[model samples]
Target: MAEDDRSFVDHYAVLGLPSSEEGTKISLEEIKKAYRNQSRIRHPDKRPNDPNATADFQFLTTSFEVLSNETTRSCFDAKLRTRRERVLRDSFQNAKRRKMATDLEQRERSVAVDPSQEVRRKEKMKADELKREIAEFKARRMKKAFEPLNRKDNVEGEKKDSSLDKGRMLKAIWETSAGDYSAAKLRGIFETFGIVEDVVIRTNSLKKKSSAIIVMASKGATVRAIQSMSGDTTNPLLVLPLESIAPSFSSTSSTNQNESMGPEFNNVVGAGFQNYEAFVMKKLQEAYEKNKCM
Candidate 1:
């Protein structure tokens, strides 16, 4: 089958990203990485002894081979319109086939078919097909995009928590998305944060905070990374400061700041690495000034 003729991944869909609104150009490494993802899923060895699986494998392999080349992905995008369209085309076709089979069963049963119903059914079926295709296209793109996290346990099981290895101590936290780590991007995410010494996520879990820790690579870099990702979903910054973590999570609001400002909870009043370090520092300095004056 032709790659575009119901037999290839849409290039945009494969990348797990939307086509660039700003005319962003595709890069070689991005294409290569996407192909690598398709390879893992569509490789024949991973498939069972099913004819459909084999076809899927071949199709996926072809997609990778073709799209990985700079020229091919550009051509494919024009043909597919949006990445979603390419992803959904095959799935839509498959659903059409199933509906045809069911229609055959209905005919055999001599089900009463109103002419208007048939017309409406035709229109509705078309609309539903489009929706299904779009949804599946999204799913396919996300699947490929996050293929890293959703792989077999061998990959995820490698989540490193405590590495006495190489004298690298760790206090890292593995922070997957809300559900299972359905993608293998955790290690990179942590490294992006501060290069904790180690990182790990459970094989069949989706709890954020995987408990990977690495020492910060550079104070400047780590700080910048943290500042940039304040509202990050995987690692939400403190809505309240770290110094406020104890009180923020513990109490609703600090109505009596004077009464609660005790030395024992100095740690609790410190800003976390995630939010407002400057403000925390300023507050500490202000308190020192007041104490000196007294």
Candidate 2:
């Protein structure tokens, strides 16, 4: 037979022996026993009426010849192993292709059933991504804004005084549409009224507005800034003292002038100031007068 024809045949199967153990473990005696039994059963003389009996008997003889020799048996076993590996590889590839086709078909069916669901799912994914990006952007911006303060504290080798009174703080609100203002710009603008210790800018993205927490060196500077900036048509900022927002000092009824004024506010509100309330009223009057002149 041709080499191709020989490769296609399972030699041990023809003699009715287990093909798995045939070449590796089957003894020569065992192969001979199987061959004798098969030869007797398939001999052409025994099946004279069967025309294909001759061909079958010839193939049986060839199988016995191949398996009986050690060299031929080893070669046949190698061919069988190669064919089995090729078959397994092809089966795996076909299965993979079938699973991919099935998945694609299911997706198409689902989209056809409810196309709006796909649209909604994609839109939700985009919205979630946008929210995450915005959150990260805001976090980066906050870290950048405070980096200078952090570095300054490190260089000075001192912790900032957290117990400092909030009474020296002023809130300045401005429209975002006006322009972008940095801490340095804000400090320059407010330093004309008093010594600005710190300027912290905050923004409301939704409202399109910005505000600054301006900490002055003393309560006197805080009151001076509030008096000068309030209701000033020239200045865009709307300034309010922290005392007005949330009063820090105790109120007292005083008949004598200058009796209730603290040492910090003595220079800002000179003589005739009866109390803290009177000093605030006087400053407001002065601001009104200044604006009326302007």
Candidate 3:
């Protein structure tokens, strides 16, 4: 049979099969199975302009020529058997060949390690470590990004995070270094945003300072800010994108809100954003066009 006409072919050398391995004694059924798999992988049509692939395809063609014929298979089997049976008894030749291959591999690995690669890897590691130390920045950005994700418009309408039967809300507490200015400065910070309904920062019994259970005007907005910061603690400077503060929800029917007006109730709190007047108008326009409100 011509090389191209064969369904598949794999030289034992190409497939990493030991030199001793031969197709003569193996069942024809096994060869066909292997051929189907290797043919699809090494087919020239499958690999575009790959020199190794072209060579491999050629070798496979030669392999098929030998394996598919009973007479040719007999010859290959005899040669392979002879080589393996002698390799164990003739240790000197076998050891020398193995040593040469091992030395070549070691030299290749040495060349693979360019000094530039080590420099880049260390630089990346340092940047990541710096970010992890500045945990406060990551938290703030995470809070901002996540706050706006809340589905303010529950399917029924005007649903808040605590209200939804399913869905979660962002709950990130502000972080400040331990100092006289920390608690006061943190309070002033939250006060400036006019978003925090309640914030309690204190030195714990362990003498460690922490902020707990802070409420936000828009939990969704806070979360949006934070997620935008980044999950990779590599760069402290890459704050979350400010534009992510806007909630992504389109509209919701107030009727869908929990009738009980529980934690899910939309509290008419002031957002206190600097561009409040402009922002409110934009939201009003969006709500009007959607025809969500009566």
lDDT of the candidates, in the order given: 0.52, 0.75, 0.51
lDDT head-to-head 1 vs 3, winner: 1
lDDT of 3 at 122: 89
Task: List, residue by residue over 1-294, the lDDT tens digit for candidate 3.
Answer: 245335433355553343455444566556556666777899988998786887877777677667667788777677667655765667987788899999999877875966577788889999998888788788988899878654644543654544632212222222234334344554454444345454444446554434343444574544433343233243221222122233324433333222222343233122222133245447866886789655
C-alpha lDDT of residue 235 in model 2: 64
Which whole-number lDDT from 0 to 100 does residue 48 have in model 2?
A: 96
What's the lDDT for candidate 1? 0.52
Give the poorly placed runs of model 3, Cα more than 4 Å off. 1-10, 13-24, 92-294
Candidate 2, 1-294: lDDT as tens digits: 357656687888898988754456888899999999998999999999999999999999999999898899889888888777877898999999999999999999998999899789999999999999999999999998877666676756544455668888988777899888889998998798789889998987898778889999987788787666653556667676554411223332342222333444333331222233555666766776899899
Q: Count the backbone clashes (under 3 Å) in each candidate.
A: 26, 0, 28
Report residue 57 deviation for candidate 3 (angstroms).
0.7
- Mark the regions of model 2 whose C-alpha exceeds 4 Å error after superposition: 1-7, 21-23, 125-294
Ranking by lDDT: 2, 1, 3
Question: How far off is residue 84 in model 1, in Å?
Answer: 9.9
Q: Estimate each model's TM-score.
A: 0.23, 0.42, 0.26
Q: Cα deviation of 104 in candidate 3 (Å)?
A: 29
